[model samples]
Target: MALTVSIVQLAISVIAFPIFLLHFLGLWDRTCKKLFPYFMEQVTKSYNREMSAKKQELFSNLQDFAGSSGKVTLMEIGCGTGANFKFYPPGCRITCVDPNPNFEKFLIKSIAENQHLQFERFIVAPGEDMPQIADNSMDVVVCTLVLCSVEQQEKFIKEMYRVLRPGGAFYFMEHVAAEPSSWNFFWQQALKPTWQLMFDGCDLTRETWKALERGSFSKLNLQHLQAPLSWKIIRPHIVGYATK
Candidate 1:
């Protein structure tokens, strides 16, 4: 019986080993592109419903801006699967920026549903570098749950600053690091490597709020809160807007 069980385990390992190697060798990018959006679609639906009140209040500011202006121009960094499309105000034109090109199809579908907002363009580039977008041309810049994965929050914030017109607003919602010495923080640190690998480069312990503060926006109105109970590790969050 022991030998039979050992052989079964060995066969399983042999079958799984090559797939793991392929994932490490960059073949996983294709699989991730196909699978992550489907996973995100379900996750975003829960987030939107669970955090409805907060999302509404935060997006109200942008709605006001769009209503006041004849044609408000908005740019969204890391606009994954266009999950925030339903929250945008009417008549606002949006520029979507995302490194994952696979998100384009999902974004188009979302855009079609939210016909109130105009889809100006989609740029396949990281938020840290978007020279194609003219400086001081955007009325609002939106970011949600993106800073945790960005290579440099400072650079990303600087890019937002550069692109926003005078008095433009940056709307952000992000999950950040838990308090030090806490059990959540310890788990975040211990599981960071595996978490990031599984979640497309997301860092569970990023001090994203600090990076936003370092940007010195003309007016910052950020507040700290805990994420939903479902998200145990990456629970600490900051959500609000800043004016450039």
Candidate 2:
């Protein structure tokens, strides 16, 4: 019986590994967009229900900090689909960077519809390689739920820090590993292989906030919220602002 189970597990892993590699390389985004409308629907639904609230709160707080500072230059790394468009401060000049070249059309169209919005630029580049933007030119840099998918979190954080002027803020919300518990630890260990496969190399067990804290931030205002589940098992979220 144990031998049969082992064979089944091996078979599952063999099937999943290639799919996971495709996801990591971003082939799944184009291939699955049509077949995965339900996936997109769930993403949109989750954004509208859970993520929108968080974005509004974080943006509002960041806006207040920006205060009378006129027309702040805002950079959003990994601004996929421009979903955070509605939450951007009025009169803010925006520049978006994403590794996917296909994201350009959506970003351009979104900006065109909003007359108040002005685009400084859009570059098809990773967060760690934003060469076009000058150093310390941005007032705000926003990253939302993107850290886990980044190949080098440390490099990304350093790039964010390098671009921001002193006193500039980094607003972010990211999913992270849960607190240590027997069941949670077990789930993290067991499900990570499969979870990373489907989710573009996103590891549920990454201590993303701890990594941020260790990075070169001047002021770190961090808060954590657990998702609706066994708190130690699934979807632990950390959201906050860090200053450079």
Candidate 3:
């Protein structure tokens, strides 16, 4: 039985290795975006209703904070299909960056539909490397549910800091590993292999805020919440207003 299990594990790793490698090279975003609608449908169905409500509340709070600052300039990294479009303030200048070229069409459509909102531009680039925008230029940087899938979280945070103007805020919402619990830890470890295979290297056990701190933001305000589950697996979130 042990030998058989070893062989099976080896085979699974062999089959998934190429996909993982491609993910590291930034191919996964394109592939995932192509299938995003289908993925989202399944996720929407499976996600707990209360969890969704909490997320909505989080966005509401973020919007309120952003709105308080008059005519803020915003940059959203990994703005897949502009999921947070409705949360942006009406007169704010917004720039969205995503590697998916297909998102541009959706963005244009969203902009056209929402004539009241101010949109400055859309750039096709990975968050880790955004060359088009100058340093200390943007007033606010927003990232929602994107850190887990990024190839280099540390580098992305640094890039965000580099581009943000002095006193600019970095707002984020991410899913993370649960706290110390036997069952949750076990499940998280067990599922990581399969999850990485299917979900573009998004690990369920990453400490996202640690990576953000490494970026050297001046002020960091963070909030953490857990998923409603028996296990210690809190969807360990941190919503912070970090300064550059």
Candidate 4:
């Protein structure tokens, strides 16, 4: 199985080289608009939903903010397809943000299905900087499976802290790199080139928890665990909440 995974990754690297070149020429994003979103939905939506549901405690800090605003005000960064909607408490007002404009139609579709929550608006912005959202306003912030793809981890975490209220909580779940000396780390590094090209800037070995600890969060609770996936290439996971 290990040999097979390595061979498959090598083949992918060979195939992705041309796409990587296309990316530099600015033709890749334009060409893969529909293909990327649909493929992402198919690949991650179900797995994300199931993992978030099982580790429901990540959102446990939300109750403290229930009556803070007539309802809990939540901002979800990189909220692709609105996949985490079902896991939120009832009546929460959610504001969605993502860098891709192509996801609006699909996000609207998901919002339509989830009648239990109220959506504030959808903003086309990356997680690193969201000046549109006022500072210290949101009661809670949520981001799942998105840190790996961001351009810079520290800037994104800092932005989350900036938008959060004095007592606001930021919930995060991400798949990270395995141990450096382990066999999986070898594959992660080997696959880095093609993997990032195939999936928009997503690194297989991002130690995001370190950046979170460096942020200005007043309190943080982080846990390391494995995601419920059959493959080890993307299974190392972390879930936690940081209070500002």
Question: TM per model?
Answer: 0.88, 0.80, 0.76, 0.90
In model 4, which runs have C-alpha deviations exceeding 4 angstroms?
1-12, 49-52
Q: Put down candidate 4 lDDT per residue, 24-93, tens digits, no spaces.
A: 8999877776567787777766586557565577775576776445689999999988878877888999
How many angstroms is residue 98 displaced in model 3 relative to the true structure, after the best TM-score fit? Answer: 0.9
**Reference-based TM-score, model 2:** 0.80
Off by over 4 Å in 2: 1-42, 65-69, 112-115, 182-185, 228-234
lDDT of 2 at 215: 86
Which candidate number would show the highest TM-score if scored against the true structure?
4
lDDT of 2 by residue, 139-233 (tens): 89998768977888989999989999888999988878877664564466556666655655667778898789898887898999874433345
Give Cα-based local distance difference scores for all models: 0.83, 0.74, 0.71, 0.85
Query: For candidate 3, lDDT tens digit of each residue in 1-244?
Result: 4454456556676778876787789997678767764564345334434355655665554344343456778899977656666666677788999876666776687678677678899999999999999998888888876888788898898898998888778888777876646456555665667576676457877789888777787778777876553334445666656766
Clashes in each model (backbone N, CA, C under 3 Å)? 0, 0, 2, 0
lDDT score of residue 151 within candidate 2: 84
Looking at candidate 4, what is the lDDT of residue 209? 89
The positional error of residue 105 in candidate 4, measured at the CA in angstroms, is 0.7
